[model samples]
Structures are given as C-alpha cells and as structure tokens.
Target: MSHAHDHDPTVPREALIAIAAVLLAVMGLAGAVRLGIVPQSANPELSRAAANVAPAQQRNLRFADREDGAVLVTDADTGETVKVIGFGEGGFARATMRRMAKRRMHEGIGPLPPFTLTRWQNGALSLSDPQTGETAEIHGFGADHSATFAEMLEGARS
Candidate 1:
C-alpha cells in the first residue's frame, strides 16, 4: 500500500503585510522629495568650486527690452545705451530678450518692463526684471558665444 500527499507553497500573511508597508513607506518618501519637503544634498566639490571662483571683470552690463520690439543694452552705472539690438536680429542679445518674453508668458505674467543684466563681483551673471523684481543667474557668462554681448557692452563704454 502507498499513500500520496500534496502540499502548496505559500507566503505567510505577516510577510505580505510587511511588504505592503515597506512599499507604502517608500512611496511616501518619494512624494515628500518630489514636493520639496525634503531638501536634496549638494555636492561638496561644486560648492567649493563656486566659492573659489574669481569675480567677473566686467560687471556693468544692463539690458532692457521695449514694447516696440527693441532691445537696449546699457551701462548700469551711467544708464547709457550700450547697443541697440533690433528686432529679428540674430544675436545673443536678441535671443536673450526673446527668452525673457517667453518666460514671462509662461509664468502668466503681463507685459514686462526692462530688465538689467549685471555681472556681480563674485563672478555671477544675473538678469533682473524690474517689473516683477525677479532675478535669474546666468551660468554661461565666460563662454565663447557670450562674448558677443560682453563685447557689445565694452564697445559702448568707449
């Protein structure tokens, strides 16, 4: 005589509950990070590099875009026109003006007054909107293409 036995493999109820709890905790943590409730860590090297960077040599360039599609690059100290970047002109200044307009529209803001671009003593290039009192830092100040705007500003002073 022979007896046959059958068995089924199954996870314990406790294990299933534990797994669900872990998943929920992970999701909650992710949501917190996405909502900026938890601040992210910064790279130490980048922070050091930023701190050690030299100040910008030219720090007086300011720019303003008019309602009539004209861009005026000026000196911040003297308020003199550095250059007149005309509409449809293919240049960095014009491109920057267009970008500013697009950003304003995206933010659901109305007409924007002139903005000022200044290179700070700490080598930070900033663009400030007078209307909204908003300032944005430009990271690509010393790049080759950015030389056009810098050159224009320098030329205007002379």
Candidate 2:
C-alpha cells in the first residue's frame, strides 16, 4: 500500500536554477581571475610584507658538473671556477651533486640552466635549481660546519 504523500524524489526546479546560477557566477569569477581582469591582492599589509622581503644574496660557491665527471664549485656572482671537486666512486659531495643532477633530469631541464648557491639575507645557505624552481637549504642562517662544502664556500669568497 503506497502512502498518499509518497512521490518521486527530486530537487525542486527553483533549487536547480539557483544552483546553476551560483555555478555560472563562480565560473565567471574564475575566468576573470585567470584572464588577469581581477586583481589578486586585496590586502595592502600583505603586499607591503612581500615588498619588504630582502633579496637573496650571492653565495660564495656555485656548483656545476662537467661531462667528464667533475663537480666544479665556482663563485656565486662570477662564473669563475673556485675549485673542482672530483667525482669519486662515492662520497658526500659526489652524492649530493648526483642528487641535484637527478632532479634536473627528472624535471627535464637542460644542462645550460643556471644552478645557484645563495646565502639569503638571513644567512641561510641554500642550493637552488633555478630551472626547476627547487631549493634545498644546506644549513641554517648561522649554523657552524667544518665540512668540505662549507670550506669550499668560504674559500670561494676569499
């Protein structure tokens, strides 16, 4: 026995039309943002904070590899090779360099792209792959280290 109030379950036409209108409005807003017709920023404080950030400073050494299996650490500002860290069978420096190379390969970047070593204004040491937009922080702003990489950076500056 069916109850008198029983009927097909469905959304009301008014609700459906309201949903469609809201969806269309959202799409139009998204399209405007995508087309650069709408300004992304709405907060002046955030814009000021972004503008206040200090630029990254050039590091002492920039590392690049050669086809013949040589890791050349050079000056960050100048392209001059400060030292050549030979690619040995296995070592920390070699392993690190290999990881960077693998990341470049994964990103489908060419060898000619700039690989930068930067010391930010806050003194954090970082190795950056500009081509892939990947950055690895080597050490904290003022961390102490006596490793070969640290020594290399120091020597490059001198």
Highest TM-score scorer: 2
lDDT of 1 by residue, 32-92 (tens): 8888897545533245367775334443555567787777777666667778777767365
Model 2 lDDT per residue over 26-83, tens place: 9999899888898666433244357674434445445676798888777656677767
Model 1: colliding residue pairs: none
Per-model TM against the reference: 0.43, 0.47
CA shift of 149, model 1, Å: 3.3
Q: Which ten residues in a row have the lowest lDDT in candidate 1?
A: 149-158
